[model samples]
Target: MKVLMVEDDLALGDALGRVLQGRGFEVTRCADGVEALAMFRRRRPDVVLLDLSLPGMDGMEVLRLMRDGGSQVPVLVVTARSAVQDRVLGLNEGADDYLTKPFDIEELAARLKALVRRSHGAPELRCALLRVDEPTGAVFRGATPLDVSTRELALLKALLARPGQAVGKEDLHHAVFGDEPVGADAIEVLVHRLRKRIQGSGAQLVTLRGVGYLLIDEAMTEGPVAV
Candidate 1:
């Protein structure tokens, strides 16, 4: 699952990101509310982990904007505000669940899973022989299980999420590296690895110059000669 974590605290965000990634999640984080909202629209994460005290815009306004924009994606408010009124306000403003800061990491993870499960059922995604077992975060080719790193799985999942549609390099970077400070060639290297793994799997990863990469079924694209 993809999670858009909107938190201004650097330490907490970094720690949570690492933990969540270990627990079968693709986490992209933004510190500012403005950037968070923009990422929300672009990334279309399965769920959002929102912090009320944010810069540029408060969490309440961000939630309001999301609802205003007709987004029904689940939002979980994670903040230090533990007052009953605060929780009520958050829910009233469109938050699906609330989590007070300093909470247990396991609980947070469970809540995230619950929200995503309720909002979007865990459905397996596929493109030809490349299949993503959403529940276990496993990638399979036909009856064989293919070994893929977390980053590779993230990239493949992102492409498979939208079959036959080209995904931009920037978006792929966000999905794979999140906010990590990697080199410009990081994505290229990752793509090269995945392109090799999916070879002869009936799925082709085609690169569109100046656009990005897309996954398509090779069998579906083949046609008879036009005489």
Candidate 2:
């Protein structure tokens, strides 16, 4: 995947660019927000890693401008600010994901993969006769279309993307809520709604005791059942 990384710190920027390149990603590094925005429009990268502090324009302003200009490219905000308010503000401004500084490279890669996966919009997730579009937020059971909210659609996409894997609650939380603080039962509520909407669609939503939720189609795979 191609990525644009905007960071004022030259050393860190070089290190990150190298790391991502090592992982088979084409990276373009920019030292300021203005350059970052320009490169973004010029390259149209698959993902953007934006730093909060920049030389010319601030990261928040850049994000606002991108959204105002109708740029829906997935953005992952990387900043030193660990405060909840800072993260919240970034999310509100249009960041798809937020990671504080001093983070593990592995986690960063995972988040990037998730973001890119969502952006590319996986073909079709089939569980029995049901099918879903990971990109356009379209859901279908056989030939019928089901109405679903954006949040519910995102939740379903996150679940369907993993197939049989058990997606942890925290990961799902981040995918759906971004930086917002949601209650423990929030996932349950959303799952309930999804289940209702997908009724008779040959797909099932199951809970894994203390782990998290899983969406399964009986025809897809037979494994250890968690309910």
Q: All candidates' TM-scores?
A: 0.54, 0.57
Report the alpha-carbon TM-score of model 1 versus the true structure: 0.54
Give stretches of model 2 more than 4 Å off. Answer: 123-227
lDDT of 1 by residue, 10-83 (tens): 99999999879976899999999899999999999999999999999999999999999999999989999989
lDDT score for candidate 1 against the true structure: 0.85
Clashing pairs in 2: none
**Which parts of model 1 have CA positions greater than 4 angstroms off?**
121-227
Where's the lowest-lDDT run of ten residues in candidate 1? 218-227
As a whole number from 0 to 100, the lDDT of residue 219 in candidate 2 is 57
Model 2 lDDT vs. the true structure?
A: 0.81
C-alpha lDDT of residue 114 in model 1:
60
